[model samples]
Target: MDAVRPLPDFLVKRYQGWKATTYADNRGWYKRLAEEGQRPRAMVISCCDSRVHVTSIFGADQGEFFIHRNIANLVPPYEPDGDHHGTSAAIEYAVTSLRVGHLIVLGHSGCGGVEGCYQMCEGRAPHLEEKTSFVGRWMDILRPGYERLAAGNEADRMRALEKASVMVSLENLLTFPFVTKAVEDGLLTLHGLWTHIGEGGLETYDPAAGGFVAV
Candidate 1:
């Protein structure tokens, strides 16, 4: 506590002033969001990493989007019962209840989960109970991607793994009954996106092109 930095009084006062200055627009914003009840047209599937915030990247405010986040932003192949379907539940809620028109799988660079998969394959990490380390289990989803990438040169393998993971997630998204129904009915469109944290580059899935193209 003694070594902790204290807030600058000037900055604190400035923050207080900022509220009053921006009050006109913000005063009813929360209430408006509550009343509107998140009529978002799009649902974003993104990583749970602290660094990758979908709302901040999209410049979206409350009720603007429905979002689901998980390790590597993965959409697991739908399997009923036993397993908790956090991402699927969100997807079902968004697609069925909210009727979102778009579902985006947002991938990013330097992903810890992706890296963990690589490490796990190399026998660098093992399951440790009560530790919450996912190197062993989470990597199961990316096993195919890792194998495909490992067949290539080191540099290419990394890039391929990241891209392939996104592709796999897209495929998995289809396993959900609601998602499949929505897509079949032409009520929903699925997209894959790769984001570079440092460069801020965006690559969007182009089904016609059969690859991710810059967007």
Candidate 2:
């Protein structure tokens, strides 16, 4: 393959600097992680939004978490019909192979994917409704959430759907036989989280409360 263009200088420079500084300071830890392999205690499924910083907020070191990110941070119902599923594959490996004790589905305020789904379900984004729209197809998993949360004004509904998206993923995760078995055997637990970007706040889902409360 030929170069489309030279890589951005700033990104390259930043990586080089971080490699020399942070990695240098943690060389021994990095070497130990590489030799022993990653044994993360938890697996986090979050959105692809650049603003969402899972590691910085958790203050986690390298190899502490098995993280998977996709738009809207969704997980679809399990289907073994010989189809390609990236999120499912990651979850399978994390639960069955890695044996992670906790599985966290992290949603965020002002999620573009959630907003898109809201627009899409309301017949606003025809382009997203098209079959070829990868994001639209992926967000179909969140349609159930929007349907259940169609109350209130647009802004409130969108926010409700954002949290609903996390709930939906947490539910779908249990649809996997392996995941169910792990949870039933007390080998795994499920959690849902929603973050407020500008407010720098996080909230945990309490199944009993049936609503989000600050954390």
Candidate 3:
């Protein structure tokens, strides 16, 4: 294997600074966490976009949330076909093992993964249509959402698709037997959230209103 290089100077400096301040300030809390293990109240499935800061958005402290990030913040339909499933495994662990009270799917504006899914569905992105493309296959989960989207202008359509991604994930979460059991047993609740990246606006899906409303 190739020899590993040292961390970037800026990152190393930032880590040292944090260690001197944040870690030092919370040393006892950190030690307790290490000994007790995590017991987060919620599991958040969020996009892997760097701009979508899940912990910062909620002002979550260390071990407050069990977060899983992936392309488009998606959850695929449960398939116990013996294939590797990273997202499914995380959900199972969060629900069945950690017994988190809430499962949240957090989608955000200007999501490149959602845009790619929209483009692929519209036949405007031939590259993403290739079977060999991992993103294309992964985003196939959102095709139903794309098909359900109403006709609109480009910008509006993209924004709608982003929210649809979150809704689709929420629906897919129910397909997991463990998730279904947890919900039915009143041990877990599911939530769908979307944020406007530029304005820092948050919205939650309201089934009664049949749309997202500002939170």
Candidate 4:
């Protein structure tokens, strides 16, 4: 077995810098969080893309929002087959345990996961179609969204698929009975959001508009 190594020097240095500045400045807040525990009011499910900075986007402080990141920011249908389900577990914890008031699915432009799903659906990504590929299986959750994509050029379709992924996640959230009850009793609200990576622009899903409108 290979021996585990310590963190890279750059990361160590960055952590030291943050500890001296941000952590030092917010020492009391950190202590309070540790003593009181997290009581985040909202939960955000977003893409694992490095550029999708959920905290910076919302100007949120530490321990403010329960954030979960996955490839393409997808949510699978409720399943209790005694298997490992990371995303579902997080949702259950946030909705039932933490009892967050709002759950947001945040999708982003130029998502590699979404692009891969598009290629796979179009029969261009054979590697992702392989049965052994974990990414392929995980991205399968977005297949329905891909099928619902409207007619458009490749770029437009990709953008639409990105948004559709958020909608799909929102739909799947309701598949969880706890989420449905919370939403029905007005304890929780669901939101779908898409953001442009380059422009830093955000749009929210409006059921009345039946499309994304700038926010």
Give one digit per residue, the lDDT tens place, for model 4 in 18-76.
99999999999999999999999899999999999999999999998999999999999
RMSD, every candidate, angstroms: 4.3, 1.1, 0.8, 0.9
Model 2: worst 10 consecutive residues (lDDT sum): 1-10
Model 1 has how many clashing residue pairs?
0
Q: Once model 1 is optimally superposed onto the true structure by TM-score, how far is the C-alpha of residue 140 displaced, in angstroms?
A: 1.3
Q: How well is each residue in 143-187 modelled by candidate 3, as lDDT tens digits?
A: 999999898898998999999999999999989999999999999
TM-score of 4: 0.98
The residue ranges of model 3 lying beyond 4 angstroms of the native Cα positions read: none
| Model 2 clashing residue pairs (backbone) | none
Reference-based lDDT, each prediction = 0.82, 0.95, 0.96, 0.96
Q: What are the TM-scores, per candidate, against the unseen true structure?
A: 0.83, 0.97, 0.98, 0.98
| Candidate no. 2 TM-score | 0.97
**C-alpha displacement of 2 in model 3, angstroms?**
1.8
CA lDDT for candidate 2: 0.95
Estimate the lDDT of model 4: 0.96
Per-residue C-alpha lDDT of model 2 across residues 80-193, encoded as one tens digit per residue: 888999999999999999999999999999999999999999999999989999999999999999889856888889999999999999999989999999999999999999
lDDT of 1 by residue, 31-124 (tens): 7877877799799988888888788788887678888888888877888887777878898899999999999999988888887777677676
